[model samples]
Target: SILKKGGIVPVFEPTKATAATLALELPLPSEDGVWTVLYPASAKAANTLEDGLCSRGFVVRRLNTYDTVPATWDTATLTSAQSTDIVTFASPSAVKVWSSRLGTLTPVACIGETSASAAKRIGFDLVRYPDLPGMDGWVNAILEVIESSSSSSLCKHNFKA
Candidate 1:
């Protein structure tokens, strides 16, 4: 809406999902126009699709607009807390943001394929993602993972509808 109404260049995260949205919404290769990407500082590579566009002669510029700082974990608090069953990540950045915070966990659920790939790269043992998209789909995938894993404790927590 912002792009169409106010001529605002869309600023997007570096992810397949964001790329797909941009491709569908925008016409590429404007000689005098610019597309800006707001990405994390720690990422090693540029946004995949945006960089691809630059190669193809589109003017895509990037800004390292954010940083991920893992929250300090307290040993005493964690030791007293109940064990986590499943950790959920909606974006690749979320996986990266939580990397230092996550020590060891099983049966991680990602919202989509891109995020699942990130989780796998981060050494999450069980990375599961929804076949469909969005929050409902991700939740269903998580439920499926929990059912398949046969974790009785998780099933007892009312995750199902």
Candidate 2:
């Protein structure tokens, strides 16, 4: 949306490495120039984007534009989630919240490595994440977990996020 509004043509890259390669192809600054980037507060701990760009001789100014907060789950929703065959987590915040509220007995499918790591640190025995990124990979990971769990016991094929 920002690129579209700014009339900047975007080269879509699926991974950070690919994006860094693309950034390397960009014209280098005559002098070190600051590139202002608006990012979510949740991702501040992993500033790979800024670090990568900076390494290419571009100064980066990151602005914390937003933050991710856990949503309050109602009693019925929480109960339903607890009974699910698997739980999917997109962010560490979600994993933390779910672990705190429901405990980590059910298996979890995480969207990315970061979330998967968080789940592991939180004492989740069964945590799965795809090598590839994005919703497609995330969904595939969930299905893989579900299939694996089904072999052990009767799985309802129900997943909650």
Candidate 3:
């Protein structure tokens, strides 16, 4: 939808480096032009995209869409999660929620760098994420962690998406 409307997206991977470089690549806004940004409500308040675009002379209209909220888990579910060999997370919110609830030292396998970074920041000792972001990459990361463990037995994995 954004592409059809002629909106530009960052070509580089989403990281601090990309954010810095993206500022240099954005085109100067036309006179009195406004850019509407639809973003997740859970995203950081200091939106880099809106800030960069506004600094480059565009009036940005930011809209908060759906938020990523923590899911409520029953005691039994939480206990099961704690017993797992590894926990897989698809989002930063999930990692934070899991850490808060279980506070276990079990290893984590993330679907992407963002989730992995969150897990590490939340004090998880062992975090793994694949180079690419997708189900295949996520599964590979989980497999890698499982394979490297001293136990050769099948791993009981817990997925939080």
TM-score, per-candidate, Cα-based: 0.62, 0.69, 0.65
Best by the lDDT measure: 2
Segments of candidate 1 deviating more than 4 angstroms? 1-26, 29-46, 80-82, 93-105, 151-161
Over 1-161, each residue of candidate 3 has an lDDT whose tens digit, in order, gives 34446976645443322333445565554556564444444454347667776677666677776577777788898778766777898777888788888784877888877678789998998788887545777898887777665353333333332
Local distance difference test, per candidate? Answer: 0.65, 0.72, 0.68
Model 2 Cα displacement at 77 (Å)? 1.9
Residue 11's lDDT within candidate 1 is: 60
Cα lDDT over the full model 3: 0.68
- What's the alpha carbon RMSD for model 3? 6.0
The full ranking of all candidates by TM-score, starting with the best, is 2, 3, 1
Counted clashes in each candidate structure: 0, 0, 0
Q: In terms of lDDT, which candidate is stronger, 2 or 3?
A: 2
Clashing pairs in 2: none
